[model samples]
Target chain A: MSGPDLLVLATVATLAGSGIYLLLERSLTRIVLGVVLIGNGANLFILLSGGVTGRPPIRGLFGSEGISDPLPQVMILTAIVITLALTAFLLSLSHRAMRLTGDDEVRDDEEDRRVIARVERELARHRVREEVERMRRIHAEEGFRAGLRARLGLRGTVRRERRELRRRMREEWERQMAADDPEGGMDTTMGEDSP
Target chain B: MNNVLVPLPVVLPLLAAGLRLALAQRLVRVQRGISVAVLAAVVVIAAVLVYQTDHYGPQTMHPGGWPAPIAVMLVVDRLAALILLISGVITLCVLIYAIGQGASDNDESTPLTIFHPSFLVLLAGVADAFMAGDLFNLYVAFEMLLTASYVLITLGGTPARVRAGMTYVVVGILSSVILLIGVALCYAATGTLTLAQLAVRLADLPPDVRLVLQLTLLVAFGIKAAVFPLSAWLPDSYPTTPAPITAVFAGLLTKVGVYAIIRVQTLLFPGEALTELLLVAAACTMLVGILGAVSQTDIKRTLSFTLVSHIGYMMFGIALASRAGIAGAIFYVAHHITVQTTLFLVAGLVERRGGSTSMDRLGGLARVSPLVAVLFFIPAMNLSGIPPLSGFLGKLWLLRAGVQEGTWPAYALVGVALLTSLLTLYTMCHLWNRAFWGDRGKLPERGQIIEGRRGLSGTGIVATAAPGTMVGTAAALIVFATAFTVAAGPMAGYIDRAATELLDRRAYLTAVLP
Candidate 1:
């Protein structure tokens, strides 16, 4: 109830580290035990997070001076129960795995592993090929556009032609409006200048 | 009605199993009938609960009329209802299949007799798990199911089954012990056992404390869900079981863990860090799972691996913590539960026909058993995310949600998802190629048709009895899976609503604690 949060956290972390170390050991029994220890460390971390307030959260009747948060306690209860059931099931699995194959360490079935590895290699190759194809298409498009531009003088000619065409169209439109309305005879001077 | 019904899910199978084991030794028919009838009644009750839950909010009934957080309560929410519906339909089909298959070649074996009772107990455990409102109750439910599963997996005690069962039991025991430690720690931290209460209480805890608790809970559930790194036990253990048992376990067990993860992530710890961690775990799960699945030649093993891989998709949705993601995840759960089980059942049928689950031993099944081929084909395609199927729709929603989130990781995960889908297709194709498409390879030798000598004719007739039970089960599931597909708009909407309900947490938290 009065331990430093850092110390509590450190203890759990150490336990977890040990659990992982055990897990790394090949035997199924050690691996399961490692898992169990790791889980304990995790639970301890959760407990430490609630803070070591004055007292455990069991406030009964009337005024409460200071009580620990009740939420984490309840959550841990649920979590503990679940892990217990899970651990049991997993332990059963580990024991059976050991018996089925005379080895304690999990050895991948050779055939299964080979097939899996081959499929992965193929997928990786396919992805690389796709990337190459994408780059090639991008390169080809750039070359084609550049070649077409040179042969046609398309950029400058298109720009100049569009400008000239716009000027002519505007002048034509103005003359047509003036002719139809006959309201402004000054359009005659403009036509003469244009000719 | 409320009182009895509230506890029936846990009590019925347990009581029936106890009685059958003790006094009903002579009357096998009576034992089987009672077990089946009780399960049927559980299904009916669960259906009614589903209807009621949809109309009203979640249905919570406390035994002895005690207030929640003090007395144990059974709450059936939309998610719970969905699982119940699936469990019901699957249990019915499996029970029928078992009945049709005639227990075993040896009727006198105690294992054969216990099948009915054990199967019922498993269902009861599942029901209790779904309905439990308190964390401690969930543990009890888990134990109930595990105890039953232990019996079912090792029922015949054949060398292989026992071997597999031993692994299952040991792993299970280890998880239980860890769970207990975690629970004890939680109690020391928060001092309560109710879920809703803990949700509020947990938020108030210091950040570090909360994070630690959250991670511990996730790890426990992760193992159950078979998330990538923790999933080594699944492929070996699942494929070796009898079809019906495998089917149920495939469909419901892992999903239950996922359901728990969803509940914990959204309801208990809505922190951003947890979501981020979940997203990463999900990505690893999907990529790693499918990769493992692709290399397998045995149909059952392949599907089992895929099952682990596909769990990532569900986790992806849940990890996003957005309404769309959670909804998509929920829909994915429903879809995967049906599709996955159907695939396993199909594998079972193929084994019956071809005398082996290995691709080498099986070929040309499509020629001999068109019905089996079709059954296998539909679910296979559906699982691979083909259009107009629930699998495709579920993935689509999840990917869209991921993209919409626009986080770099989420976007990258969407890409991972696309790749996984393709790989799923490839492995499924492999199963199709070797199991259904060839000549004599597709047919089981007459000896393989029936395993042993006791009334081989009767059993063989049942085994080859058109594989109707298998087909029928697949067909019914496909219909539901398709319903999720065609009605995805409405179903997704329901999921969205449920997601909102989960995220808001007002109803759940207030109902229990206030």
Candidate 2:
């Protein structure tokens, strides 16, 4: 009962590694398999606790001194029965999941998904609003610059700047229209929509 | 001390579960009556065990009359009896509520009959867990409860429940596996599974090995307890169940995990072996859980997240590992079980009257059902720790304990604990404003009420008023929870004594071993 059993340990590590890999997958069927694998690995762990091998814990076979403890084996049997019940339940659940959704991939909790989508949508709208604001600011600065140029008597340059500003503003307006999905968001399009 | 009561809590329910299943095909009233009687008897037994353990120090009973460290050992001390008493009452009330709901509903949307056996088994599991004297028995207790929970949660196998139950069952069994591994390591290190024996033997192990064992057990229990990093499964899974089932699960299941942590800390790895580790975890659980609560739109999910958040307070108490801290944690646990279950039950009523649990959809519930409004208000305020309530008292004691300990991490936790409380209040206030105070929004069109109580779940609707049994049960629990404030003085003293015996360990160890 002293030193560890390398073979059982190695098997457990392997089963657990593969089991965890499957466990991380979203598919219910795979997760069930992962549970089985890891469950067996855990069973081996319990068995290993009783030591690598033993003088059969037979009551009369040998003096009790040399006989390996039977508690861990008894413990594993109980664990296996539990694992069996859980596995059966999981299998039925996966079947139900498959029948309901046509696949057993776990769906996000609908509220969690709703929250994520709403947040993402709001963030996208915010970015779009900022871009339009930046564009409008540039347009205002351009108008101011074009007015100064016209006053300074550069008609061609002023006309060109004004045309360019108008074209740029038109493009920004189109983008803002698509992005303004929420109520009243489209109302904010008035400033940028002006020719 | 009359130790015979110890086994009754675990055994009576199991025997009744079998009888319930046997009678499942026959009269529903008899089945319900038997289930109720069994749980009522359990409450009386639990009460007796409480007085006996408080007076006699501790009591132990062996199944099959075998001695401890051999046949299954069940021990009742102040800690187990206190929790057992509350659990017995909660389960009884929830069962009554379920029966009331099922009897009146004509639709078969849920199998009302399936609840009888499973609920009894679940009761046995919870009782067995609180009294389990060995780690393996504790594991068995966990499996028993979890197996029943999986059934209860997925009762109707609706698309939503099936989806949620998959996650619930998978995460649950995975935790069991990890727990088994931890048990294996403990057995290998100490060559025994009894709690008292491990307490004695573990102290002599190398600190490194001891830490490994401690960390292993923590990770397993932490997942079950739904601590910060491992709590995502709770809100997602819990809200999808029928309300009564959700109430019991919310009130008792995570607390079982917390109870195990208490046992592990006090008996197995006593002293401040991982105070800093548990403190950081507690702080994170509080902050992360409350933040999750604030962001949820559905009241059920909101309460589910809050359930996770509140567990942090217990963790904070246990992490301090002081007498006052443990006492505070125990008090918080008792207060929380009643309040959390009450809140969920109220949420169920909100769904019935207000048409939806979604905050945006529910409005003017105060005017719609004054009784429901008041029912919801008390537990919600108590949960957020308003003054003259049990939640506030529990928090005050825990934070005081943390301050008295006076480590930097303890200070950080106290600060985090206060912040979490405020945010919880903020979330509750925001919920009140939207659901009860504002203009009545569009009530769900008759066709739009989404829940199916398995019978009239979504159909020929009954009166918007909650049924008498449901309302009475919820009101009874809320009153029970509020009464804690009135009894705070004596209750605190009792748990303080329980904490002393817990930290001392000798009273428990010799009681089981000698």
Candidate 3:
């Protein structure tokens, strides 16, 4: 590599590096400057690629040996025009951005944040609703079971009381009968009891 | 047909845009008529080019009759013609949709005077990029389109649009600069900027140098194509633009980047040096992009993510580096342009009828406008890769190619692709449930809700019904998407031929250099 080549390479590196660094900034002006730096770096790269130092390509001007590649120059020219146009666009956009937000910095998308929050809230509401529905079903089942147990307990109590009354009635009847026919009843009762 | 028709696709639009600008002081209706007629002519020319290229092989033209290697040339190969035809039709439909919107609303917010000319310029740029036979010409074509898009994206000059436009312009400029550097590096290595010449010259270079050049170009084009890591600028930027603008950008712009990548990967660097890397990128692009879509609550934002995700499918095809894979990618590109554009148009109509594009604020559109719902349904399903749609056919071809490639990464990508499709469906269904099937009574009363710039001011203004032309235009795109499926056999055959020619470098070299 020669002197001009080394310088061109260094320039490309510095410009591209700083351009990328600036592009990462939140400020719109810095971003535009980044674009400009990158554009210039690209132009220099194209120029360097055309060869280190050469005279302009004119038909008979100083022989064709050292004449720079005209193609890269043309490309650089077109690139410069494009960059200028984009810079103009960026400037206008920066103006508009500043006007809208009262700043030249890029603002985060408020709608996106709000939408995400809203979606989270919606999901939470859905989960809560499902949870409440599940609890309600459990509560209904528990109440039904309690009501059934109470009814079953009452029926058990009524049956026991009825059995006791019947037993008493039978005993009273037996007593009366026993009184009426003591000897026969006593022998028969004893035989029945033994069987 | 004369080779002169080769440049007409690009030239006619530029001329019409110039004419429209001159006639700006005239009636808006007149300007609209001229724009439509011009784009319709472009569509016809594109169709004829497709037929010519398919029958007779690639067509080439030198603008000033200079020699092939010295003069700038336009090559209308099968791939270029096919993309041109599809984009022509899409731009026409979008123009009609915008005109309908403009006419119906008669709102001063969106100035028709600026839009018509800018849109025409955008068309010209797209055509130029598609047909460009040189790397520098492709860069210029990109700049043409990007400049025009800057104008269109910030049409209303709203604060939100300005912010989005800032990101878009910055990203676009940065990518172009990178591309310029790549072009310069290629030129520095090889003494030419013409792609065919570079294709011939680049193969002789050492593997290390070629790898560097290839990576440089891929990084530049990847940013443009919105491939995963380089794609964050897309979702934020695209959704804030006006509907037709977003539709066209989603349809054509990123695809142009994909087209450039295809051209270079097949023509300039024909080996598999970067295959695994690209495959990894493709897989990541698919999974990560769709995941982003799933997280978005806005319809436009979700669709933007889907746009990025599907670029992965194209990259997958490109990565396979086989005839079938490239062909499948071509077919996928065509299918995606139509389906994605159609979906965005429908979203626009939904915004018009529902008074908001936010899904939570939208509901019962199915009942309010059955036509809008139907319009949205067809394209949404098509986008989600439902059976019998072009999306399904494209994905199927890509997957089959991947399986035939039979690598672990390819197979893994197949699984990822299927999963992406399912996730895409989930996103679409989520949108459907929130925007169409939810309770109508829960919605705030319909009103003229200006978006982005204004707060939700429901001043008791009733939302107007969508104009028939807008719905018809969107339906026409849906019909085209369906037609893509119906004609899948022939379309696939065409794409296969295109891919074959693209892979066989001698065909393009001979066509141009001869």
Candidate 4:
């Protein structure tokens, strides 16, 4: 709206814009710089929002219009302290990162990528296992039906084939029961029932 | 009203933290005793505040006896009191867990000794955030907690912890800056910082300016709450911390952000201007967050993703903007704080017992320690929204609210919420299967080799017997979560009244500004 206001706005915009730009960089130092710039920009914005520059608000201020709002300055002071602490923290982090990885640049999170890949592989393995189990069941059912048809057509092997089929069915039942059991115990009833 | 008790929850913890710091070089046991006593006192104070507020309306205290508009004020209504009580209880449990952990370690006095003071400071920050009656005060409160978190997160200064802490610190500072900008904008528009006064002044601002101010605040708070697109830093950073620190952070920090959001939305900007936007964010946060959870391999990482996902349910309640919805959100917040912290604490135990948090290297926990298994199972099931648990009750309440709202988006969110709950169950079961039920022999040996190779030997999971106090603290959290279910009827009634008072701002304004 006025010259001082426009200058403050431009400065805030430039600082915030550059801050965001640096934030997108890969190095930890650049990121810290970004935070510093953005914090300064915010403080400036708060100061600007207090109104055009005026005398510091003190006990002897002429009037409200003649005195600058002390609240924003107080807020800016707090923000500055917070930013300084954060900057110091970030600098230490950068130093630590350099010591740990021998570099100050942020590396891609290989663990997360590996985890996603592992999860996908696990899901694929699970799907394959389910499909194999399904196919095996279908094949068993078909084989049983075929064996029954062959036994009825040829009575000579009927008795032997029926015995074999009964044994296979008992095994299948035991397997199913074992899969369903929470305790993973063998079902003793299968042997008794089979006899 | 006993206004004297209003600031005690915050002040007591601050005093204890200072005392702990002064005695930092002394015996650790003395520090632990003082920290625990102060937090216990805060819990009693919180409980008293809850009783007084519920029976006699909100209580307010202005520091230095200054009037509300000009000086810092602390207000303890039912919502704040409930949050304070739960945070105090959880912090106490986690403090015990930390002490137990430190006692078992070789370096009992040096590096780990700072935990007591830092944790007490964190509790003070939480209490202050919950009771803060002004927006700027809330910002300061956030910084206080976050500063302590930065220290806690990188406790050992390991490579991984440092890396994660860098990201955490950067994101936190960025969000704080955005929050400051929002506060400045709001002050510029409304000429007041006190929430009650802002409530009166904000309604008179131009609609466009109000919307801008509201969206700015929401964006900042959303990042802190780990709402969608803003939540990527959480899973990366949270899994690197020690058990007790991670448990407290996961339990209370983001919820503080959510508390601030609730305060502003209900008090300063009570309208449906951003409801649609929030609904979309809630739905996205739910689906995306859980999907991420389903994809994680480590127990802590999975729980972190689930934490992000569950924030959606609270947002769903907030977006609904109905009394039932808000009440459900409040209850869900309480239930989630307990259950989530319990699960993390148990995960810590699991790591201690199994030698690795990665599921590929963990197994036979059920056989190894039945108590740990049972502790993990209860909270895991509760968090998954199992019937008859507090999680189920909270989700049911939210769904009922959604159905009552009956908009197409709301219905869609109802469906998403249900799906998210089931998916949560699936993820928990996935963790349970690999970490608890399987044979120890079935675990891959390569995963153990990788853990050793990562140079994470100091913080890497180890097969140590969990201390009795650590397990006891986790068990206590589970008991609290169960108590939530047992006392659901009365708790829901209290939360409903809190929500009602929240929606009707005159009570809050009169209490603060009078």
Candidate 5:
């Protein structure tokens, strides 16, 4: 029935805030640290939920009326154990990752990278096709629109548009080749972009 | 019998896991036998629990005869029992498949000693989550299963598994922490963690406070359930693991989250109005998930995305919040767990015989292995909700429930669900054409597909013929999925009654507290 301690609440907030910030980091070690902090914060918050009574929860050692709620403490202990297990597991996993790749930063999955590259490559091809289609349309309509464009003095704009399309098609083809780079040197690109 | 069976699902596997670990690398065959035996026993117990809970009522068991408000209580209601039975069947079959795979490949990457123990522990955690009558115990159950999954996922410690496991672990931890915070808040508000007790007390709180508590719990479960944008990690993480591990995780892990959402939404906040929010989440999850699935070239990743997509169907059913809707949700969960697991197992076969799960590299599997083709075809069609399949029946139930609800959002969700089904069908056709029907030698892009991507180097894979046990196990699950269609009448009836029992919170309250 009593109010929760403000100090405890503030501490929980700080720990959780920092923990989450660190959690958003790409480094596995930092994420591990973040998880640990957040876990402790959660434990503290749960403890606070039981209401702050400095008295022991033991019924006989302390008057029953003044005894703390034991359930949250018990739950916190369980949480601590689970968090500990997870921490150890994460550390070992990070160590393995570090050993393999010389750093523990979580890398983008190869399959996901492939999927993205495929998307980019497909988009590039689509753009090239669209440009080619536009060129074909321009060619097909040349007999009709050429004289109108000449009279309108719009030939420059048409020529400019065609030149731009050709440039875009060439650029897209280059990008498609880069994305299709067989070794998937995705490392040079996606390593920095991975979440 | 209820008392004996209720805790056994959690306890039996846990105890066997300890014994298996003690046996260690020595007596590896014996260890495998123990896991199969333990999971089989759990499946039987779950089946009986399902029948008992349905016939009698929700059955509750408290540890050490402690008081209701604080003690860890396990309840096997109709929903829990049904999910437990289905997951038990899944884990058992997947275990058999894993054993067959391990026996054949002699793959050292997934050291059998760790695999069986981790798998059994995951089984126990799943059972406990299903039967957990208290919120805190549910948290523990989530941790237990997830930790086991963390091990299973990173089994080989390969680079791909590690990278994938990192995202999966981080996301999982984030959800678990949120779930813990939710549990703490619930306890703070209600002065107890027992769900039945909370069901009574939560109603008395201010509406705003209740809404806050409800949204908090929903977000936590939504992440676990892989509701979008929360679903981004699933397809990224799931496909990197070994076949059996991925099958079990895909089939049961996300569904566990869905099960939790169903439990809390129905039991903890029955009258609370979050239908609009849930409907939006469901629609986005369906659309985005299927779109992602359709775009994936890898068979496993596509199936993983579809797994996320179909979860939206269950969510749609839950959002409807009617008896039919709830029934549909339960039925969909049952059907999905079986079908999804079967599909993943088949994907494993595709990876083995066809030399890759990537469609670009895999071809002519129908000719290479007719059995694998048939296996994949059945579940793939079922996943797309083919007319005669259980998936279609489950979707029809939801669509009917949505129309019955007769709201704009409900109509939107129904349309989204229909579109998702079609998209799912499209993915299946794409998979069939690229992986099964097309000849590998004739693939135009076969030379250009990423050859150096570590795992997807299907171009030069030394193909391994799948063992009979693995194929037969997958086939058994396919038949089981098919059986759901044949018995859709009885299954629907059972689910309908279960839904009623769930909505009538008074029954759960009285049964647990009496």
Candidate 6:
């Protein structure tokens, strides 16, 4: 990349970094600024992607010294207009929001946020249950295979060893089941023996 | 045959509004009559253009005989013509109502007069948006509508109205800006601004870049259409406007956004990502919007949420990226514009007779004005997807398309849609029970609440006119909506044809550039 391309890239990188930082801030104005900066960064990236070099690509300005790719420049113009309109509107929205709610802080709608959190928690719970069930099935299969080998006379296993294996497998299954349940433990397990 | 007619819908309104502003010295009736005549003419012309386009395919008229690639191309297809037709017809009804309702005073009329022209310009903007052949032209069309809408939303400049309008305007402007940026990026990526040409060239770019371009366009359109997360601005802002204006905006503005989404999806980037994003957006939008509607106490606000919720249904088909899906979406658009507008119009009538739009302030209206109740019932049922109504048919078609897709997401979306439909009825029932029935105890005395500025001067007359015209205008709109219900079959076929035309861009390309 040449001088201008490098400059554009640096500008884009800085804008992107700053934009992300601002977005991470809690204030609505900073968030808006972040969005605007991100947009500018996107524009710069587009400019670099066009891969054009030399003079600005306007008609009748520079005839023979060759032309920079006009495509990205044209695209940038449209981007600029759109960005300007969006930023201005966002600024006004920020002002209106401040006036109406009496704050520029990014206040959340309590009801909506509560609903979303509930939904997320439910989904996460379902995922955890599925994962625990899979682990239990794997453990049961491994124990059953080991017993089959012993029954086929491949190893000399005492009664104590068989009992211990059974107990361990049962314990693992119980642990898996309990892991899936968030409310302490399953009620069905309350009257069960230790084994 | 000049593309001039394409701009007429927008220009006539703009010019009339400007004239109304300039001719402040003129009689109020004269100004009103002139505005009415102008809008009526626009409606007639739009109807004719729609009919003609039906028979002749899409019409492309270039202003000043300028060729594409350099000059602006005004395109009028069946889709645009239909929207223009809707806008024109609604405007006529609203104007009649405006006249019958009469002015509140000189200051109100001055602002009100601005409404006539602004409304006309809004039509023009819709036309321009629908007919725009290039990306930049689309931006301009969007600007035209946004500017006009800002004026309409805060027409009388009430503090609440102003605050609401400010949010609306800001959101609208931001969306436009986003769209413009996308357009610019598009032009830079591909040396052409024409949509058809971009459609062809965009296909050749790297997948990543193309994805970005498609997403940029989608985000911009999505914001305008108020899909899911981007739709927060609509509920508060839309309900703050007067009933008629709210009716028109609710019916027309977001649909324009839907229209653009359709155009771009069908024409430029026909991809899985765009389609998937649209589907996800549709699902979320429906669930959230209806849920919001369910919780609202104000009838206008409730309807506004429903409007957002129903938009997802239309997006359902567009997201499907199939002929049947798009057709269903097209039919849904027409059905929704009429039904939604009529609902808002009735809301205005209810507010007038019952003293407030809040359910808490009003009750037993069905017992008092059975006519208004009957008028509101059909569309309410239709909106909730009752069988044998246009809403039901539109939903049925969309559901069939979803089932045909048989994808897990699509199936889930169908379920969501059905649930949303049920909940929609639940909310509408709440409105009906609270507004149309319930104990007659302590509802604000009829006509006593005085619309604040538009209160009656003497014996239910305001500003030297009676409200009979307002009622008549609303009744006409209701009748038109009923006709749409009656003609659902033919309307569906037309929508299918329009969808086919949109997907097959050969004609659209040849007409505009050739």
Error of 2 at B304 (Å): 1.0
For the predicted complex of model 4, DockQ is 0.20
Q: Quote model 3's TM-score.
A: 0.87
Candidate 2 global TM-score: 0.89
C-alpha positional error of residue B94 in candidate 4 after TM-score superposition, expressed in Å: 0.5
Q: Per-prediction fnat values? A: 0.12, 0.53, 0.50, 0.49, 0.47, 0.06
TM-score of each: 0.75, 0.89, 0.87, 0.87, 0.88, 0.78
- Tell me the tens digit of each residue's lDDT in model 4 across A17-136: 999999999988898888889989999999887876777688755766677878889989998998898899889878776765556777555354455445655665565565556555
In terms of lDDT, the poorest run of 10 residues in model 6 chain B is: B456-465
What does candidate 1's lDDT look like per residue over B1-514, in tens digits? 1434556666777787787778556877787777778777778877776677667777777886876678778877777877787777777777776664554443445445667777878888888888888776776677778777887776544334544565566566556545555555565567666888777777778888777777777777777778888787787778756777888888888888889888878877875546677778888998888988887877888988999999999999988888889998988988898898888877767766665677866777787778888888999999999998988899999999999999999998899899999999998887787667756563545445433211211233223524455567667777877888777777777677778888888766665564
CAPRI band for model 6 = incorrect
**Per-residue lDDT for B1-514 in model 4, tens only?**
2388988888888898888778777866677788889989999999999999999888998877776688888888899999989999999899888777766653454446666777888888899999998889999999999999998888767655776788888889889988999999988887788889988998888899988999999999999999997988998899877788899999999899888888888888887437788899999999998999998878998999999999999999999989988998999999999998999999888877775587877888888778999999999999999999999999999999999999999999999999999999999999899889879734333224222311111433334568799999999999899999899889999999999999997788888876
Off by over 4 Å in 1: A1-195, B1-4, B103-108, B445-467, B486-490
Model 2's number of clashes is: 5
Candidate 2's docking class is acceptable
Candidate 2 lDDT, B1-514, residue by residue in tens = 2367689998999999898777656776677789999999999999898898889889998776676667668888899999999999999998888777776565433365667788899989999999988999999999999999999888766666776788889889988998999999999999999898899999999999999999888989999999888898998889877778888999999999999999899989887548888888899899989998998877998999999999999999999999989999999999999999999888877876765677977888887778989999999999999999999999999999999998899999999999999999999988888899877786654344333223223233343577899899999998899789888888888899999999999999889886
Docking quality of model 4: it rates as incorrect
In candidate 1, position B490 carries an lDDT of: 72
Stretches > 4 Å off in candidate 2 = A1-4, A62-65, A127-195, B107-110, B444-463
lDDT of residue B184 for candidate 2: 98
**Which scores better on lDDT, 4 or 6?**
4
Tens-digit lDDT string for candidate 5 (B1-514): 1376789999998999899877666777677778888899988998898889888988888876887666779988999999999999999999899888776655423356688888999999999999899898899999999999998888757566777888898889989999999999998888988899999999899998898899889899999999987888898889877778889999999999999999999999997648998899999999999998888888988999999999999999998889999999999999999999999998887776765677867788787678889999999999888889999999999999999999999998988999999999999999899888867533223223333222222122235567899899999999899899999898888899899988988778988886
* Candidate 4 residue pairs that clash: none
Cα deviation at B73, candidate 3, in Å, is 1.2
